[model samples]
Target: MRLFVGGLPPDITKRDVEGRFAPFGAVAGCDIVPSKGLGASPGECRGFAYVDFEPKDNASLARCLSL
Candidate 1:
């Protein structure tokens, strides 16, 4: 399952997101949405991200905690 994490701090990184959700379950992948417009770096996030998990159950648990 793919989970959308929004309102993330500008300084947040992919490793940070993985670490936070690691306790919940294995993270298949994580991608922070890049900021748009002039002077935006690839490493910069648009205050949001998408985290992928193997099983739906783990994703569901993470979702609950996020809320």
Candidate 2:
């Protein structure tokens, strides 16, 4: 199941996000995206992610938390 997540802390990583929703069920994967930038890269966080939860309940909860 796929879940969209937003509003995250700068130090937050894919694993961190993955763990947060893990309580719901098994986690297939979590994709944490970075923001657009140039040299030095700005290193800005996209503040969002796509999490794949194995169980339907987890996915549903993740979706709810995303919004």
Candidate 3:
């Protein structure tokens, strides 16, 4: 299952996201959206990201995440 994680710091990195969610379940992938404004820095994140988890671990991990 895929989850949307928002409100992250603009400089957040892929490794940072993966580390946080690693304990929850197996993260299949993590993509941090990049900023696109005129003054946005290179490699700066857009303060949001998508986290992909294995289907088998989705339900239980989702429950824990909600709490």
lDDT of 1 by residue, 1-67 (tens): 7889899987789999999987777788999998998887767889999988878567466677799
- How well does each candidate superpose onto the true structure, as a TM-score? 0.76, 0.69, 0.91
RMSD of 1: 2.8
| Residues forming the 10-long window of minimal summed lDDT in candidate 3 | 57-66
Which scores higher on TM-score, 1 or 3?
A: 3
lDDT winner: 3
Which is better, 1 or 2, measured by TM-score? Answer: 1
Clashing pairs in 1: none
The Cα local distance difference test for each model comes to 0.84, 0.74, 0.94
Better of 1 and 3 by lDDT: 3
Best by TM-score: 3
Name model 2 segments beyond 4 Å from true. Answer: 39-44, 55-67
Candidate 2: C-alpha lDDT: 0.74
Query: What digit string (tens of lDDT, one per residue) describes model 2 on residues 1-67?
Result: 7878889865677778888977867788988878765632354557888888776576466566689
